[model samples]
Target: MKMVIVDKANEGKKLFRYIRTLAPSMKNGEIFMSIRKGKIKINNRIEDQGYILKNGDVVKIFFPDEIIKKYTDNDRNKYRSIDSNIDVIFEDKDIIVVNKPAGILVHPDRREFKKNLVESVKAYLYKKNEFKPGDYFTPSPCHRLDTNTSGLIIFAKTHFALQKISTLFRERNGDKLYLALVFGKISSSILISSSIDASENKENKVAVKEAHIHNFIPEKSKFIEENPTLSATYVRPLKYDSRLSLVEINLWTGKKHQIRASLAAALHPLIGERKYYTSQSLSLSQMLNVSNYYLHCYKLKINGYEEFKAPIPKKFSQILSEMFKIDAAKL
Candidate 1:
């Protein structure tokens, strides 16, 4: 018999749900038959499939050793090992925050089996003896950052922390500040209020539409009509050269590619943004020697928590110094 102990992650979940994680390759019919034939027991007693697991609960499986091995084998081998140079910004018993570099995916996708930030966080925790296979909860990112957008990514070390952080983001109680280098000089602060809808095209894209028709609506009528998926960004110009502007963006609503799409619609596409702004002449890589998009999540603040800041990347600083001829350290 193989024994398992419920941890905080799997606590409060249904027995079947926990079992699926343990034996993902096993069929539902096989699991049902095993339970019906007294092949599973909870705390030394046979429990129904709907049994609610709690912390410290014990589970016993009476399957052949080979079958159990097939079910419990760690799939970590399927992922590539991340670079050893990952940066840990903060860590505690409940959560960890890391500085995710640009060009690394935050999570795994079917298109790529390569290592991602989440897997890297798990591996980091493992080396510290804070995580292990079959633990009740594995450290996981509470939110995401686009592969090219570098900045602070939070990971929950415990399931409780995960739930709490997830709720905080869902309630929009967190503040996220991004810094971007755009193509044109923005003279003043402007609020970009628009409803963002998913593009009808197969490729993942978003369309931003202002609430009312321009000129037809009175200036006072600019109060944004409520939209279920309304996205708002407050852009404040920090510094600008004749050709490029550095702007600090306060993202009030999080949507897929909201910042990139919104800024592009406002005629200030982010430098090196190939998807939203396709102008070949505006390519920063060709003119300014910058290859990647110039957007970074520099700061994040959550309710009841102190603000966190990620230092601007060196390459970003290089572009600022080269193009604007200003000290990036000050910005």
Candidate 2:
């Protein structure tokens, strides 16, 4: 008999899947038959294949050494060379918050990019021995950020945390603040509400239409298009001159490119924004050497949890100083 102790990595995994990872050569019929014959036990008690594993649970498999050895490969050794380059903002037993830099993907989009935020985070925990190889469950991110957008993002260290944090995001029970540098000076706070249709281009681009308010009817407003998602953003100028302005945004609704598209409709596209850039904004970007939009998720607060903030990037600060002639540190 061979014994394995369930660690944090395997903590919420099912017994059947975990066993398959351990002994890859075992056929499906053989595994089910083994479980039925009491060939596998958890904590010295016979359990079904569907049993969910918990940390420190001892699993006993009455399999021959040759059966285990011939099939299982070195899954851990393949990840040994991965090193984390993440900037940690907060960490706890259940979750980790990181400052993802601009240009790195939170998750890989294609096969060409091997290094990403998820791999880096796993490697960080792997070094601490909190995670092990050949486990059914892996550490996962609770949210995502655009590849060119730099900001704070959260990763759940355990299965329980992943479920809870994901629920919070889905319910929109958290507050998120974004900082953006845009063209034109604005005086007062404005709320931009529009309908965004992403079905046309397979999410590569989105079309925005304004929500029209009717004077003929009571104070009711509706989107003109059918089945398009409605999105709203509250934009307030923080500091601005005649030519440029720095703004803070409270995204009332989360949609793909809600901020970027909404602002472009308002004729104040973000500096260096590619997908939603205006001619004037594009000209300014060329003058300022800005390649991508300056949009950062500066602050986030879960409804019941403490607020977390990520500092503005150095490149963002430099642009503010040179364009607006205002000190970013003071803002």
Choose the strongest candidate by lDDT: 2
| Candidate 1 residue-wise lDDT at 128 | 69
Candidate 2: residue 220 Cα off by (Å): 16
Q: Tell me the tens digit of each residue's lDDT in model 1 across 6-87.
A: 8777788788767765665567988777777779888988888998999999999898888776554544332224453578
- Over the full model, what C-alpha lDDT does candidate 1 score relative to the true structure? 0.76
Clashing pairs in 1: none
Cα lDDT, all candidates: 0.76, 0.78
lDDT for 216 (candidate 2): 32
